[model samples]
Target: MAERRVSAGRRRHRAEWLRWGSLAAAVAVVVVFLLSQGQDIDVSYGQSPASSDAVAEGGAGELGDVTVPSVDEMAALVRADDVVRLPGAIASWDERRVREAVGDAEVRILVAPPGLDEDERDRVRDVDDATVRVIGTEVTGGIYQASADSAVGWRAQFAVGDVTDQMVALIAQLRDRPAPEAVDQFDWRDPDEAELAAVAADLRATGVHVGAGATLDGIPEDLAASAFPDRRAWYVVLPRQPFGEPVPRYGPALAELFPDTPVVVVYGWWIEYHGPHAGDFDEVVGASFYAQLGERLSLYDYPQRNVLAGYLARVTDVRYAGLFDRPLPYRPFDPLRVALPALPWLFTACVAVYLVLSARPLLRRSGAGARTGVNARLAGLTALAIEVSGLTDVSGNPSLTRAIGKLGAAGEALARNLPDRHVRSLLDDAEAELDDTARSLGRADYRPDSYLSERLA
Candidate 1:
């Protein structure tokens, strides 16, 4: 009897030590995480390999083995003989740096426009091979061209049945001169002479170079001569495949007449379709239509600027100048990665400790633990409500608080042998609150007071 008692006591003592020790370890880890958190990855753009490796290591826990090369590393990819392609809109070229980088080598600047047919693309390719080496998808090239001929570069007058207010104002501003001239309109379906005359007058009043769609006879020799009298290059906007026909074969004439001067042809009607849209922003970002190296490093706005800077740095044997716009913030290391994986074991330990400590009281009044059980049930429902409703941190919801309180009260009543109707009523009210929250989340009405949390929650 004495030996058995001693063995039992030792087992209890060992079990007690383990429960407390496990709880202490978990608490210590959580406390340490809270004390040292919110650290961000520090990325040094073209810093040394060691610094780049540090950035890679910083986010290794979150991103998992993703390593972004530094600007210096990317610079090594560009060869001296490679033609650096740039978007025409980007004018922030450091002339000295460009000259120093490539010496006498020439680079291509793309100006592809929208709705470019295969034939048009081929023509552009011919031009590109001679000048710019065209490489990229149709959409990418089109976006590159669109950025080149942004609103600021509009010089030609366009006439359509439904013209935007911006287009009208742009036409007026571009053509408005000392002498009143008419801007011609061609109503393709009706072919209204009076309406066309009126539209022409309105456009000409602003001193714009308006075309009278009178003769599609190969862009009248006189108009060509008049337009390019100085024999200088010009980015001209031509009518869309005159009279809904295919683009006229004017390349031969254009090349012959302006062999010495480069004439870039743009579509007058293309602007009508390119309006403010979600996809436009993505296209612009993908176009990369600016110098890679600039004062600011924005891949969306100016990829070419950075590329140029990188090229210059490579050739000049100078360090990359433009790295990042701002310094990155510091972040704390997360222990959750380790804790989450061992959650089952940790939870089991916690429950064992709780049952062991409260075993006597639990045995005396089994219903005493029912309130904790009820709270746990309510907490689960509240979590579901939060997840479905998209709430960030809803700690002070009156309806939710009332529901939880009623649930606790019902649990106490059940403990005293009361009826289950009170619990049913509380459950109904909680369900109602969840339904209301879901309804609010689904409403799509756009109002000034509408917010993500309010609507979703």
Candidate 2:
């Protein structure tokens, strides 16, 4: 009896090993198949690698040649009714709809012809005092200018549909602007002494020197000394009213004032930085700021404290955190490549789990009962496999039908002798299922149900 028990134990161990080995083999096959199907395996996400030179060059001198109104003319038109439509800029029908869309909002809509020449863009940029200027043209689609001195024309450009549609969408976005919870006001032009001091304190708290004045020349000596000590990166806040000119005028002027030192100039609704290290600001930080600003103007429209704090955070990230130092990983939109590799493994896992669960009853049995259960399951499975194979024509072929029925009967006979009630019931179920499948396949007029037909039912 002791020797017999040892033999049974060894057999069970071998069976477990065989089952696990089969699962590992299946997994290996799946991996090999997937690897063979594709040459390159990409497991990355986001934008592709961008060259430093391309980022540094930026999108500065790309304006095409197109006539636009002079600065004085554009300003007069903006001052007239906040809707400036150049001759032949848009169709009469579109112009009427655009005028209705403007409908007394503080926003100015400038409808220019398709292409905006360099001179024209500069002239349009010169119009200094409008709250929000939207230039709709066939060439650039839509240009959203927050201020006249905007270093970058159109914080966000929309080219979807015609110029008319773009202008209407731009106007709607500004009119229905959602106020941010952090900002209580949209006026930041002339912050009082206390407000300036608060903004200065906030800037200094973030480990950067802060300087504030009506103009760059008027900044306090002590504040200027601290902010620009040793010609390093610093922050300067100026009132929107003082800089009556566009950023192209003051941005380079400040850059010359403090040569080699990185200077961030913050005005209400406008932020510009200059220095050798400020290229990333133009490439990454500026785009990020404008994108955020376009969504919620409050970032720049709010008080200096909130706006400067937000600007400082972005500046610090680009300067120190190596935000754009590495090229972002890109995953292409090939659904087949991504989904195909995962399918075989998923199917194998499910089959493995089912096999283990179904074999549990057989594994629990000992000696002759175990053998009986195993034989019964094998016979039932063999019949089911043959029925599934669709290799033999069992329909109208009485011999093939008899063969399948006989296999099921043999399994049932073997199951009857097993002491395990669960194993006996499982074998019985298998026999019934196999019989049903055989009968279904045997019918001459049978048709399979389609996905749509079943769903409708």
Tens digits of lDDT, candidate 2, 1-457: 9999999899867765665465455445445554656667555343222212321111322232346667887778878866566753421125665576667766664555433544565566677644344333222223542221122332212111123344455555567743222211121234455654554464446524344433223223343333234454556655543211222223454466457756676654356677655565466767666565443331111344544444545544443434544323344578665666565545345334434433454334425554754554553354343434343232322333333334434344443554445445544554454455446566421212221133236
Best by lDDT: 2
Per-residue accuracy of model 1 over 1-457 as CA lDDT, tens digit each: 9999999889867865664564455344334444435545354334321112222212212111112223332233223334333332111222333234333544333323222333443544544222222222111222122112322222111212111222222223333312123223322243255643443353335312223432112222333332233442233333423332333223233444435543433333222111112134323322232222111211112122222222222311211222122222344555765555454344334433532332322233444554544434433443443343223112223333343334334444544555446655665576555545444445332111232235445
RMSD of each: 25.1, 17.9
**For each candidate, what TM-score against the reference?**
0.24, 0.34
lDDT of each: 0.33, 0.45
Backbone clash count, each prediction separately = 27, 2
